[model samples]
Target: MLWVEKYRPKKLEDVVISKKLLDDILKWAREWDSHRKPLLLAGPPGTGKTSLALALASSLGWGTVELNASDQRSWPVISRIVGEGVFNETLSDEGEFLSSLEGKRKVIILDEVDNLHKKEDAGGEGALLKIIRKKPLQPMILIANDLFALSRDLRNHCKVVNFRRVDYRSIVKVLQRICKLEGIRAEKDALVLIAKNSAGDLRAAINDLQAAAEGKKKLTVEDVATTIRTQQTDIFKVIQKVFKSFDPEVYSMAMLLDETPDNIIWWVSENLPLEYEGDDLLKASLV
Candidate 1:
C-alpha cells in the first residue's frame, strides 16, 4: 500500500490540524441538525481537508457517502445517491433497518463543490441549494480550493473554514514518524529538505519521502533532492509582471508563465486587490 494511505489519520485526534479547529468541526458534526448549514472547507490541495473530513466521520462513527469530480456528478446522480442515503435514516446502504442507530446520520462529502460543471452537469449547484434549503437529515461537508468560485448563496449557507498550508515543521514531524515506523533511518536535514520543497503540501512531502526512501536503509538529502522537484520561476514574479510591468506587450510576460491559464486567472484575481487600490483597484477589476 502507498505510505500516504497507510499513514493516513484514522481519527480526528490523529490529524495534525489545529486543536481549536478540530473541536469546532467535531462540534458541528455532533450538532448537525441544529447547525443546518453544511461545512465549507476551502484549502489548497494536499493540505488534509479531505482526510480530516473522513476522520471526522470515523470519529463520529457515522458512515460516509462521498462524491468527487471522478464520479458522475450530474444533478440526477447526486439527487438519487444523496436522496437514498439521507431520506430514510433508519436503514443502512444494504437496506437493513438499524434500530440501535437512532439519530445517526451518514456523512455526505462533496469534493471540489466549487468546480461543479455548469454545462454538462447542469443543475448541480441548484440541486445542492435545494437539498440544503430543505435541511437534509445527513450532515454535508463541501470541499474546494477556491471559495469565491462557489455561488454567494451557497457560501452564505455554509459554515466556511479556511485551511492554510501546513507549516514545514509540522510536515517534517509527520515524515519523521513515518520514517520511524518504516524502520528507515531518515536524516533530519533530509526530511527538512523534503518538507521545505513541498511548499507546505503534506501529501507531496510524504510521497517524496516514500520515493526517496525506497530500496534504501537510510535516506539522505541528495536522495530526496533528486526525486523531489526542479527549481522553477517564482509565482510572485509572474504576478508582478502582470500588475507592475510597464511593457505594452505584457501578454508576452504572461506567456512565459508555467501556470495554466485556468490557474493564472485565479492568481491574478486573488492578488489584484492586494497590489492595487482606489482608482487602480477599480481599473484592474474592470479588466
Candidate 2:
C-alpha cells in the first residue's frame, strides 16, 4: 500500500495540524442540526482537506456521499446524486444509513470544488447554491485549494474555514512514527530533510520517505536529499523563497531542480500575493 493511504488519519485527533480547526469541525458536526450551513474548507493541495472531511464523518458515525471532478459533476448529475442522498434515508454506497433518526448523518463532500466553474460543471454551482439556500437535510462540506475561485453567491451560503500548510515538525513526527512501524531504520536528519523538502505537505513527505526507503533497510540524509533533488521542486516552496530572498540563488536553485524558466515564472506569478505583502508584492511582480 502507498504510505499515504496506509497512514491516512482515521480520527480528528490523528490529524497532525490545526487543532482549533479540528475542534471547530467537531463542534459543527455536533451542532449540525441547528446550524444547517455547509462548510467550505479552503487550503492548498495535500493539506488533509479531504482527509479531514472523511475523518470527521467517520467520527460522527455519518455516511458520506462524495462527488469529485472525476464524476459527472454537471447540474443534473449532482442534483440526482445529492438529492437522493439528502432526501432518502437509505444506506449510502458505504452501506451506512443516511438518517438523523438512526443516529446517522449523511455528509455530502464536493472535492476539488474550485473546479466547479468548468464548462462541464454548467449550472452545477447554481444548483448547489439552491440546495444550500434551501438547507438540505444532510450536512455538506466543500473542499478546495482556492477559495476565491468559488462564486460569491456560492461562497455566501457556506461557512468558510481556512486550512494552513502542515508544519514541518508535525510532519517529521509522523514520518518517524511511520518509519518505526515499517521497521525502516531512518535517521532523524533524513526524516527532517524529507519533511522540509515537502513544503508542509504531509502526503508529499510520506511519499518521499517511501521512495527513499525503497530497496533499503536504512535511510540517511543523503538518501532523502537525493530523492528530493531528483524530483521537481515544490512550486509552493519555490514561490516562498523567491518572495523572501532577493538573492540570485533563488533562480539558480530552480534551475538546479531542472524547473523550466517558464514554469518557475508562472508559479511565482500565481503565488506572489500569498507570500508577499504591500510594496514587497509589487516589487516582486515588477521583477
Candidate 3:
C-alpha cells in the first residue's frame, strides 16, 4: 500500500487540523442528524480535506460512499449511487450480526466538487442542489479546492468550512515521524526543505520524501535536492526568485535547472504577490 494511505489518519483527533476546527467538525458530526445543511470543506490541495471527512466518518462508526472526479458523476449517476447510498443503510448481514448496528448512518463524500461543472456532469449541479435542499437521510460532505466554483444555490444549501494551508513545520514533524516508522535516517534540513518546497502540500512532501529515500536507509539534503531538481523545478522557488531578484540570471538559472520558460512565466505571474508589495506587485505584473 502507498505510504500516504498507510499513514492516513483514522480518527478526527488524529488529523492535523486546528483544535477549534477539529472540535467544530466533531460537533457538526454530532449534530448532523438534528441539522440538515451539508458540510462543505473548501481548501487548497493536500490540506487533509478528504482525510478529515473519511476520518470523521470512521470515528463515528459510519460507512462512507465517496465519489470523485474519476467517477461518472452525472445526474443519473449521482441520483442512483449517492441517492441510494444516502437513503439505504449499508450494513450487511454479517456486519449486523457482529455489532449492534441499529440506526447506523452512512457518510456521502463528494470529492473534487469543483469539477462537477464538466460537460459530462451537465444537470448534475441541479440534481445535487435538489438533493441538498431535500435533506437526505444521511449526512453529506462536499470537498472542493475552490468554493466559488460551486453554484450560488448549491453554496447556499451547505455550511462552508475553510481549511487553510498547513504550516511547513507541522509537515516536517509528520515527515520525521514517518521516517522513524520506516527506519530511514533522514536529515532534518532535508525534511525541512521537502516540507518547504511542498508549499503546504503534505501529500507532495510525503511523495517527494518517498522518492528521495527509496532504496536508501539514509536521506540527506543532497539526495532530496538532486531528486527535486531531476523531477521538477519548484515553481514557488522560481516565482520567489523572479519577484525578489528580478535578475536576468534567475531565468538562466531556471533554464539550467530544467524549467521551461513558459512555466516559469506562469508561476511568476500567478504568485507575484507572495514576494512583492503593492506597487512592487503592480510593477512585477507589468513585466
Off by over 4 Å in 2: 70-76, 94-103, 118-123, 233-287
Off by over 4 Å in 1: 69-75, 84-86, 95-104, 118-123, 229-287
List pairs with backbone clashes in candidate 3: none
lDDT of 2 by residue, 207-287 (tens): 889989998889999988887766644656666777776777776678765334544676678777787789888887787
Off by over 4 Å in 3: 73-75, 85-103, 118-123, 233-287
Give the RMSD in angstroms, all C-alphas superposed, for model 2: 7.4
TM-score of each: 0.75, 0.76, 0.76
Compare the candidates by lDDT and give the number of the best one.
1
**lDDT of model 3 at position 202:** 80
With candidate 1 superimposed using the best TM-score fit, by how many Å does residue 179's alpha carbon deviate from the native? 0.3
List of clashing residue pairs for candidate 2: none
Which digits, one per residue and each the tens of the lDDT, describe model 3 over residues 116-235?
753324345766776677676667899998888888878888888899888999999999999999999999999999999877878778888888999999999999999888665465
**What tens digits encode model 1's per-residue C-alpha lDDT throughout 1-287?**
88989999998877879988887887887787776678999988778999999998888788877777325534555676555545655346653434435645577788878776443234467667777777766678999988888888889989888888899999999999999999999899999998997777888788778878889989998888777543234556767877987776667667765444445676789998899999999999998
lDDT of each: 0.77, 0.76, 0.76
